[model samples]
Target: MAGVILPRFYGCYNCRKRVALHDDIVNKDFVAGYRKRAYLFSHVMNVEAGNKTDRRLLSGVHMVADVHCGDCGVVLGWRYEKVYQEAQKYKESKTVLAKYKIVKLDYW
Candidate 1:
């Protein structure tokens, strides 16, 4: 019961279509001493990444690809794959959204 995760519905801001669920994002176990990456808890959808493209996080770590709106092709955020230093093997995909670019409707 300690590790069970619940699903959350999030949509692409531009498309307004369901893209991803909460469980798709990864969270790691607590580790001490080493620097930890920034954690953002939000609804994410329609993200893309590539080996050729590069994005940087606040921690100065390079992310593999830019997260874009799948339907509208808007730059929504970035994806930090295995090379993110904090997380490995695309276990943790990261993204950031500008306030004006994203909105969450709480129907719950």
Candidate 2:
């Protein structure tokens, strides 16, 4: 197993449940709230989404749902359920996990 390599992933900060792989990251220059740093991921696992609600964000009004850790039920970030702006439509169905809410699970 010396030469074998494991995929790097991010886990819930509270429960350490695997949530997303590092390779799945779509954007790293994202902000959660005012100045809180966050990352956008194309996919995630071991997380539950809350009810979708239309909220006005920095970019524009978007339908989003809060995503929580499945094991600990802690709010990590929000997922874009619907993007109203045509320019932001690429964010649809994507999940954003707060940088402060996830921890690296594997060695670099």
Candidate 3:
């Protein structure tokens, strides 16, 4: 019998809720707060965005919202709501998840 292959996913660290697919990762060299590693995903699931606020980041000022795990309410990262700099406009509407805050799942 042929074994079935499953797609890999990234889950919340607090709870094993599936959040983002490994295939959906857009940028893997992203850096989160405090110089921590992160990844920018094209899409995400099982997460809730908090209130939008303007903050100065390494890039520049951006309007972002903190994203939390829908199940355990843990802060995973932030979603880019708006980008002021024209060169950084590509980040808008994308989600950034801290590498330490997520775990790889479905790997055989």
Spell out the clash pairs found in candidate 3: none
Over the stretch 1-108, how does candidate 2's per-residue lDDT look in tens digits?
899868899999998999999989999989988799999999999999999999988898999999999999999999999998999999999999999999998654
Ranking by lDDT: 2, 3, 1
The C-alpha stretches of model 2 lying farther than 4 A from their native spots are 1-4
State how far residue 40 of model 2 sits from its true place (Å): 0.3
> TM-scores for all candidates?
0.49, 0.93, 0.92
- For residues 1-108, write the lDDT of model 1, one tens digit per residue: 899655555566676555455453444232212343322323465555435354444445554465677777776545555354654434344444443344443431
Local distance difference test values of all predictions, in order: 0.48, 0.94, 0.94
In model 2, pairs of residues that clash are: none
Name the candidate, 1 or 2, with the larger lDDT value: 2
Question: Which wins on TM-score, candidate 1 or candidate 3?
Answer: 3
Measured on C-alpha atoms, candidate 2 has an lDDT of 0.94
Task: Please give the TM-score that candidate 2 achieves against the real structure.
Answer: 0.93
lDDT of 1 at 41: 29
